[model samples]
Target: MSFTLERAQAAEPKILANGMKSFDHFRKLAGIPKLDEFFVDAGELEQLLPGLPLSGDSALDKLSMLADNDYRTYAVGLTRWNTSGGLERKREVEYPPASNKIGYFNGLALVEIWVIDPPVVKASCGHTVVNPLHLALSYSDDKRIFDERVSLELGNMLEELGYEFENRWS
Candidate 1:
């Protein structure tokens, strides 16, 4: 999971505007869903319909780091979901600018996962410098220990993260 915060310019509005454009540019390049960023507030986590571990700090950190700097923070957690039984696939990228590249792609990965009595999953797709399909499939496989609901919900949640998705089931 990742969180971002942005300190918008209170001074010249142009700075804010430039900042916004850069933010959007990176957001688009990173393949983050604009909607997810909008609806999910860090403060609203405690009040969400379902009890979730997600918080506003994660979201804030994501937004804050979009500027010409590295300011994003992330956390990792694990949960279980039903699977067809198989080896989960994984990949590694070896290159320079790992942080920024990772940051760019990581910022776009908007997933709302839960460590509830029963876990939940949702996945979404989008365009970016990186292949969202790869990211989505990795997530699906990672959480395969859960049920279809988790997968389905994961898809929706991912879409909320800023990816354009088509429901093959629907």
Candidate 2:
């Protein structure tokens, strides 16, 4: 579920030299597959397909791609993936010094999640931070329930991780 320091360091050069999409040749490296981050189970895929921002035609096309492959382990033997979490926290120890990233590698973590109505998973890489809440959308009209459930589930998960929040919305 995590990236290996060695394999990640090896792939880092390619992403650094060219953009993140560079080195397609080395895409099938010796590590975890990247598809896990994007694709869900076929059953969950059907339920969440509408949540994705794709046209009707493109969505169908994605199903076509899925039909032609074995997901979850499509290319388990290849394709390396990493969280890319702390790599940006301090690529080099200069300017303002931060130790959160280092502590993240250890078992120490302090989550300060923002309170928002719609559920959004904020992903950060380098200088890019994207909150793709749109992916949580569905065709259902009773969206408030989903929002409440998200808040509850997220709160439960955070609490299970031994995090307690102050001044958080109830």
Candidate 3:
């Protein structure tokens, strides 16, 4: 698929075009690099979620396998802080009970893809804090969507921390 998201649509349609227009627009504004890969075929997806019974041995088994794979593939970053003499060093923590809930909204197919390393706050010194870094990858066409989503999320986070707009933007 070309996935081009150029000309704006006359009106929001019931179905979201898989074209890359909206994604490109978001990427340009976020200053993110183009994605390297975006499409995944059924076989590839199967590799990640194996144990599918041919046609009725046990559909539940296949579902369990898929769910397990989903959880393993998507992870969100977690962090914890420690107090020290005048200064603090941040530590990257593991995901808590309910982490990694990144979802894709395609109008018809809305699925929550597992998050691999959700960002987490590591430490704070009442002035500055550290957050775990998470790098997301995708195909060039969808880079903009990922960029916009991350930018908006990060912006809100920094704002909540009371960080100055200039510093946060920088």
List clash counts for every candidate, in order: 30, 0, 16
> Please, what are the lDDT tens digits per residue for candidate 1 over residues 1-170?
22111222222222132122232223223332111121222232223322332222232222222122232111112232122121122222222224554344432322232222211223121111112222232332223233344345434434545432233232
Q: Order of candidates by lDDT, top first?
A: 1, 2, 3
Name the best candidate (by TM-score).
3
- Locate the minimum summed-lDDT window of 10 residues in model 2: 72-81
State the lDDT of candidate 2 residue by residue for 1-170, as single tens digits.
33232463366443333133222222223232221112223343334222322311122123222121122211111111122121112122111224435332232111111112222232332211112211111111122233344333333333343332221233
What tens digits encode model 3's per-residue C-alpha lDDT throughout 1-170?
32222322332322224321232233233332112212223343344433211111011112222112122221211111011111121222122213345532111110112112222232332211113111211112222233343344444433343321222222
- RMSD in order of candidates: 17.9, 22.2, 19.7
**Cα miss at 15, model 2 (Å)?**
38
Best of the two (2, 3) by TM-score: 3
Tell me the deviation in Å of residue 122 in model 3.
16
TM-score of each: 0.19, 0.17, 0.21
